[model samples]
Target: MPVSPLLVVTRLLRCLSIGLLLPCVPTGALAQQLASPRDTSFTVHSAYVKAKKQHPDISIARPPVPRGVRAQTKLTYCTPGSRALQLDVFYPKAKRRQQFPAVLLIHGGGWRSGDRSQHVPLAQQLAGRGFVAVTAEYRLSTEAPYPAAVQDLKAAIRWMRANARTYAIDTTRVAVWGFSAGGQLAALIGSTNGNSLFEAGSCHRPHSSAVQAIVDVDGILAFLHPESGEGNDSKSTSAATYWFGSNKLTRPDLWQQASALSYVGAGTPPMLFINSGVDRMHAGRDDMMRQLTALGIYTEVHSFPEAPHPFPLFNPWFQPTLEYTVNFLNKVFPRR
Candidate 1:
C-alpha cells in the first residue's frame, strides 16, 4: 500500500513541534534547520486565543504596571560564551534605603517554546506589591537540552544575588516561580539547592543559586510517576523525550534525577503548588508534599477546580493566581 504524501508531511510536522526534524526531513533542509535555533511557537497571545475558545470572555490583558513600580527590560543576566541570557526586572520604586524580597519567574512551553515575556504581567504585579520580581529567559530544549535550561535558571538566581544591591533585592529572601515546565525547574531548584551536579559551568559561583522558597504552577514533580503523561513517544517524540534527549526507558536515570521528588530532604525549602484541573500535571505532588511535611518543611497546595493548565495567564483565574502567589510570598518572607 502506498502512503499519501500528505500523511508523510503531517508526520514530519508532529516531529517538528517537539524539535525532532529528521528521518523524513529533506537532507538540505535538515542541515539548514540544525544550523539555527528552533522556533518558539508559544506565546501569551496564542495561549489567550486558545483559552478564549473555551472561555470566550476571559481577558488576557494584565493590569498596567502601577505607579510605584518600574521595569528594566533586556538586562543580561548570564553570558555563556557568545550566548547571552537576558532577564527583565520589575521592582517597586524604592522610597528609602530598604531592600525588598525577590522572585525569579520562569515561563513554560513544554521545555521547547515560550519566552520570558509570557510572565511579565505576573512579574509586574509582584513588583507593584513591594517585591523585586524578575522574568528570566533560559536556553530552551530546542536550543539546548535538559541541564542547559536548569543551568540557565540557576545562573539567573545567581544573577539576582550578584545584583541585589543595585536592584534593592533581598538576596536572603529570594524565591523562584515557574509555570508548567518552568514549575518543574522551580521545584527541582528548591529541592536540589547546593547540589554540585547541576552547578557545573554556571557563573557567579560566589553567589549561591539556592532559593528560600519555590512556587510551582502546575508543574510535575516526577517525570516517571504513575500520574505523569510525559515520556510517551509511541507516535512522535514527546516533550520529555526532546528535553531529555531520550525516552524514559533509555534514560531513566535522567528522569529520576530531574524529578523533584528524588531530592526532597530536611533542607528542602518551603514550597507552594498552584495547580489546574489537570491530574497528570500534578504528578508526584502529593508524595513530594508528604515528604516535605514529614520533614517539617512548609508546603501548601491550591487548585482551580476546572481551570485550564495555563490559567495563570488568563482572566478570573489570573487574578486569583496573582493573589495566591502574593499571599504565599508574604507569608514566607514577611517584612522585618
Candidate 2:
C-alpha cells in the first residue's frame, strides 16, 4: 500500500527533530554550540554558582601520574594565616646532570573557585617534557580578595626560586603559565617585576619574583575595557567586583591598579598568548599586543578557532596547546 502524504510529512518531521535528516550538520555541533566562547565567562560564573549550591564541599581529584614523571604534593610555600598555602611540584627523572627549566602552573576558576589539583595533568605533561612544574594554591575571593591572590602567586615564584637548587631547577630559566584567572595573575607578575606593591609580604625574602617568560591562556588583559563585557555600570557586579569587593564606579583606582595593562612597560617579560577565537573574555588583547610591539618586547598570540575558553584543558586542542607553550618557552629561555 502507498504511504499517505500526511504520514510522509510526519516521518520527515520526526527525522528532522532527531537531526537524522540534517546530514550537513557536523557531528558534535550541539556541543560546540553550547561550549561556544562567546559568553564563556558568564558560563563559567554560572557553573561556579550552581556548583556552590549543589555541592558546597566539592573536592577535585588529583590526576594520575604519567610515566617518567615524579610527583611531590602539599609542600608549604607560605603561611599567610592559620592555613598554609601549599603547591604540588612535578619534575622528570633526570637523564643527565643538567638542570631543568621550571614553570609555575596556575589554574583558572574565575578567581573564586578551583584549586591546584585542577592543573595536575598539565603539570605532569610539562614535567614529562623535562621541566620542573609547580602548581600552587592561592587565596580565593571567598577568603581574601584583589591583590591577595596576586601576592600569593608572587610568593610562590619566590619560594620556588629560593628552593630551586633542591629541585635541580635552572633559576635563570624560570617561567609562569596561567589558565583563565591565573592567566591574569601570571601577566600581572610578569608586568610588575620590580614593583613592590604587588610583591607579597616577605614570604621568601630577598629572592626575586621575576619570571623570564610568561604564557597566558585565555586571560583578560584589561578588566575595564569596554569590550571586556564585565558591565562597568554602577550597580552591575562583575567577577572583577567580586575579586575587588567593589564596582568600578566605587573603586576606579583599584580597578585600574589591578589591570595588567597598567603595569606594561619596557621590561615586561616575553609573552605567548593562547586565545579562543570566539572568546570575548580576553578583551583588549590587541591593544596590549600593540603596546608590547611598540615597546619592543617579544610577544606572540595564537587563537584556536571556535574553541571555548578552557579548550586547552581537554584533548585534541590540548596537545597543540602544549606544543605551542613548550616551543615558546624554549625560544624565550633556550637551553645553553
Candidate 3:
C-alpha cells in the first residue's frame, strides 16, 4: 500500500498541534550549560512607571465575608515609574507587630497587563485567616519583557523579608500563589533560583527569592507551547514572545530556562497545582504532578469537574475553592 504525501503532511500538523498543547516544563536541566551569572537583570521598574498613566481607579474590590475572614490593605512596593509596579498586603491585623505565615499572590494578565487590585479578594480572604497576604504589581512586556516580571517579583521577596518585622510577616514560611500568566511568573521566580532572564544586573543580592511552597492555577508550563489547535494568537503564544523577547520557535532553549519544572530539585519547595477541566491548553497539569511526585516532593493536584479556567477566583466567587485553598493552607501551616 502506497502512503500518500497528503496524509504525511496532515499527520505532521496534528503532531505539531499536540506539541503546542502538551507543554510539560522540560523536566531536566537541559539549559544549565551556560553558567549565566547569578543575577536579577530581568527585574525593572520603568514599564510600570509608564503604565501608571493608565491606572485603573487604584481601588480594590473585596468579597463579602463568609465567616472568619478579616481584611486590610497597604502599599508594599513601588517602581521607579510608580505606575505598573506596586504591591498590596492584606491580612488579619496583629496587636502590634506579631508575625504570621504569608502567601505572596500574583495576578494574571497575559504578562503585559493586570494589577494587584485584581487579586484583592483572594488576598483579603487569605489574610483574614491569620496568614499574611500580598498582591504585587510588576512591569510587563510591552515596556519590559522576560526577566523584568520575574526580577520585580524577586525584589518583592527581598522586600518582604527586609520589612518582615514591620509587616508582621513570617519570612521563613512564605509561599507564592498565582493564576494563569501570573502563575507562570510565580513559578519562574521559584525556578532558576532567581536567575535573571537578561543581563541587566551585575551586583546581586545575597538573600534568595525562593518561595517555600507554590500554588499555580492554569499556568503555562512551557513557553513555546500554544495548546492543541490554538494558533500563536494574542491570547496564548504571543504573550510568550512579548515576555521572553522571543518566541518558542526562535528560542526553544530559553523557553526551557523559563519553566519552573525544569528547575525542580531536592531543595525545591512542595507544590499544589489546580486545573479546571482537561482543556488541551492545560494537559500538562498531570505531567507536572507526575514529575513532582516521582521526585518525592510533597504535592497535591485537583480537578474541578466541569469547571473552566478562572473559577477559583472569579466564578460564583469561591465557596468550595475558598474552603479548599484555606484547607490546603492549614495543612501546610497548621501551627501558623
Candidate 4:
C-alpha cells in the first residue's frame, strides 16, 4: 500500500471532484428550509413588492416608516419585576392622516413561546391598508401565569387609550385579534367584556381590555382544564390546560365557565372567526360560534373547506381578511 501512494492520491482527488460537482444539500431538506419562517418571509415580501409594483395602489412610498411604510418598535408594557413587556406598532405615514383606528394583534405558540414580531408582515399589510396595527408581546406561562397575559393585553388597551393622541390612534375603535392561542384570549376578552374579577390580582393597574370587535382565527374558546368529555379532542392540546393548568374533563364547571361560549351574553362585541371545519386546529370553533350566536350576538364564520392548520399570513385569502377587517373598522370606528 505504501508503494501505491501516488495512485491512491490520484483516486482521492477524483472522488473529491465528483463530490464537489454534486448538489450541496438533499432536495427535500433544502425545500423544508425554504418553507421556514425566515425564507418564507423573504419570499412573501418579494411577492408583495412585485405585486405592489404591478399595482401601486396597494402600496405607497411613505417616509418615517420603514423602507415600505411608518413603523415604531417600543415597549408598550412590561412585567412588574421583569423587563418583559414590549410591542411593535405599525401606522400610516405622515401624509396619510391623524388618529386612525387600531388593531391589537397577539401571536400564538401554545401560550409558551410566540411573539408579536412574527406577525410583522400582517401588521405591515394592515398598515398598508390605512390601519394602525399593533403586535404586542405578553408574558407566557413559563415567565408568568394565567391572567398575566390577559392583564398585559388590558394594559396595552389602556396604553393605547391613554397615549391615543401621541400614537395618533382613535381609542374608541380598537379590535383584539389573534391566531390560535391568541385567538382564545381575544375571544375571552370579547366574552368577558370588562369583567372586574378577571382584571383583578395583577400588578397592572385595573383597566378595560375590551375591544369593539374580535377576530379569532382558529382559537380554542374553552379553558376545559383537565379536559374531558366524550367529545373532547384527544389528538390536540386544550387551551384550558395549556394556559390555565387544567382541562374541562377534570374541571367541568370551570371549563363551561371559562369557555368563551359561556360568556356570550347580551352586549357582547361582534366577532369574526375563521377556522377549518374540524379538529385540524380550533377544536370547537363550531360549538363556540353556535353558542355565541344563540346569545343574539353578531357572529360571522368562515371555514376554509380543506385548508390545513395555522395557514401562514401569506395565504391567498389574506387579502380577503384585510377587506373584511377594514369593513369592520368602517362600521365601528368613531368620527373625528
lDDT of 4: 0.63
Best by TM-score: 1
Candidate 3 structure quality by residue, lDDT tens digits, 1-336: 444557645654564455442231111232132222322322213323332344422222246743544553555454534333567776666776577888888877667765666667777777777788888877766555566777777777776777677668877778888877787776666655545552233212555566777777767665544453212654555656546655566556767777776676776677777766646535355566677788897788766755545555544425555566677766776663
**Descending-TM-score candidate ranking:** 1, 2, 3, 4
Which sequence of candidate numbers ranks them by lDDT, best first? Answer: 1, 2, 4, 3
Tens-digit lDDT track for model 2 on 70-111? 988999999886559999999987756679999999988878
Writing each residue's lDDT as its tens digit, candidate 1 over 67-181 gives 7788889999888766798999999977667999999999999999998899888888898889999999998766667788898889999989999988899889999999999
Relative to the unseen true structure, what is the C-alpha lDDT of residue 66 in candidate 4, on a scale of 0 to 100? 35
The per-prediction CA RMSD against the true structure, in angstroms, equals: 5.5, 16.7, 12.8, 14.2
Of the candidates numbered 3 and 4, which has the greater lDDT value? 4
For model 2, the local distance difference test gives 0.77
TM-score of each: 0.89, 0.79, 0.72, 0.70
The window of 10 residues in a row where model 4 has the poorest summed lDDT is 19-28
Native-structure RMSD, model 2? 16.7
* Deviation in Å, model 3, residue 233 alpha carbon: 5.3
